[model samples]
Target: MYFFLINLSILDIGAISVTVPKSMTNSLMNTRSISYTGCVTQVFFLIFFVGTDFFLLTVMAYDQYVAICQPLHHERVMNRTACVQMAAGSWASGVLNSALHTGNTFAVSFCRGNKVDQFFCEIPQLLKLTCSDSYLSETGVILFSVSLALCCFVFIIVSYIQIISTMLRIPSEQGQHKAFSTCLPHLTVLSLLVCTAWFAYLKPLSSTTSQLDLVVSILCCLQ
Candidate 1:
């Protein structure tokens, strides 16, 4: 639990740091400009951190599932080596996913303009500016990401189902409460993260940016 939480906190800091610092600097300096390379870098690390966050959440759910449902083998199942490998795998997945996104996004020709409608260099906004026929490649990447997220969501749900069943078998009301207390917050955070991310990425793209888009984009970032 501590391993996943600490990794998640670090990922959150990295994710927000990717774009927030630049946005704040621009706000204070009265500038609306980010260089092409800077925008690409921002998009890369943002996706990396965000992807890692989701993976870590999934790991944490599995960790809890093992702890609650198979307490006898918890130590054996989640040994130090296993924990390190899981954490490393999460980071690797994030890096590879981010590389795919960054490569596909920048490979497109930006004929519309360099100006991004959102505060950060988001994929959807970048796609809006793309003029080449290859934009569908990036769309495919988004679809794949959404599919992976759904798979993770399903995995968590299944884990929780077993967890709930196991909790009910426990005779003590306090034990149930203790188990629920540990799981509920993780569930809430996962729901918010997945829902907001899906809302941001899976929604229909608008040809023209609107106030609503800005609001939704901000909400996604803050999450």
Candidate 2:
């Protein structure tokens, strides 16, 4: 748990550090700006850390699920080997997915319009700002994003379902309360995260009006 928490802290720092300071600097200077290389680097690293965070949260959910719903077999199920494998898989997937997205994003050229709408170089925002043709790149980005989102969503749903089923089997109200208490924090955080992510990225791609953009922009900054 300590190791996992430390790594999670690092992931959180990486995710925010990639964009926040730069965004702040731009804001202070009264400029909406990023260099080509800087933008690409930020985009790649941001994707990597975000994917890592997703997998970490999913793994944590599974860990809680096993510890709660399968207490009798938890020891054997989440032994040292299994724990190591889960961590490795999450990190490896993040690296590979980020590389793929970065490559695809770079394949789209920017002829003139280099201004990204959001502070960070969001794939959708950058693509829209690019004067170059980006049908293929945009399609690829959508596919990758959807795949990751669906995978995480399914795992979380399954985890919660199993959790609820197991909780329902408890005979006493006290037992049920104790069980639910352990998972409530995770559920709350996951709900907030999913809602915010959907609102930020899954909204209409063509709906980047100034007011809506500022609201989402502030949320992103706060996050």
Candidate 3:
């Protein structure tokens, strides 16, 4: 889980790095201009990492569920081979999802308009700028993105529900306390993720340029 989290952090850094430096440079120059290819690359890599993180988080939640709920078979169920397979599967799924989304995104030509509103290239934000008829692409992207997000959310919530229920079954108060304490770090990370993600994608896209958005973006990068 830690290894997967670290990879997600690095991918976040890469996504942020690709966009922030250019945005800062433009701000200094007072010209919000990004090259056509640069913008495409930015959107592609951003999608890649975001998808990758989603899969990584889902895998981590599953790992936690197994560790907490199936202690007797934890080692057998999550042996080194199984753990490696889970990691590989997450990585593979992320790559495929990212590629699919990115391909759909670029299928709609941008014409000559390269003025992106947000500091980073987001899917919805980019779609808004396309000159081509993007109804099909837009719908597909939204559904794809939402499905992954909802799946991750449901899995995480279900895992926690089972975890909490199991903890409540402990006979001793100290055992329950310890069990709950084990989840504190994961809970903190999940809260931050949900909050930042809500602001970034759930809220109005027009509001992403605010200071709050930047702070959230920065926080995500730090993770």
* TM per prediction: 0.96, 0.88, 0.83
> What are the lDDT scores of the predictions, listed in order?
0.88, 0.78, 0.74
Best-fitting candidate, scored by TM-score: 1
Candidate 2 matches the true fold with a TM-score of: 0.88
Off by over 4 Å in 2: 217-223
Q: Give a tens-digit lDDT track for model 1, residues 1-223.
A: 8888889889888877887899999999999999989998999999998898899899999999999999999999999999999999999999999999999999988898788788888988888888858699988988898888789889989999999999999999999999999998898878888777877777898887888777766766666
Candidate ranking (lDDT, best to worst): 1, 2, 3
List candidate 1 stretches off by more than 4 Å: none
Candidate number that wins on TM-score, 1 or 3: 1
Model 3 over residues 7-32: C-alpha lDDT tens digits? 66776677677667887898999986
Query: Tens-digit lDDT track for model 2 on 41-72?
Result: 99899888877777877988898899888899
Worst 10 residues of 1 by lDDT: 214-223
Q: Which of 2 and 3 is the better model by lDDT?
A: 2
Report RMSD (Å) for each prediction in the order shown: 1.3, 2.2, 2.8
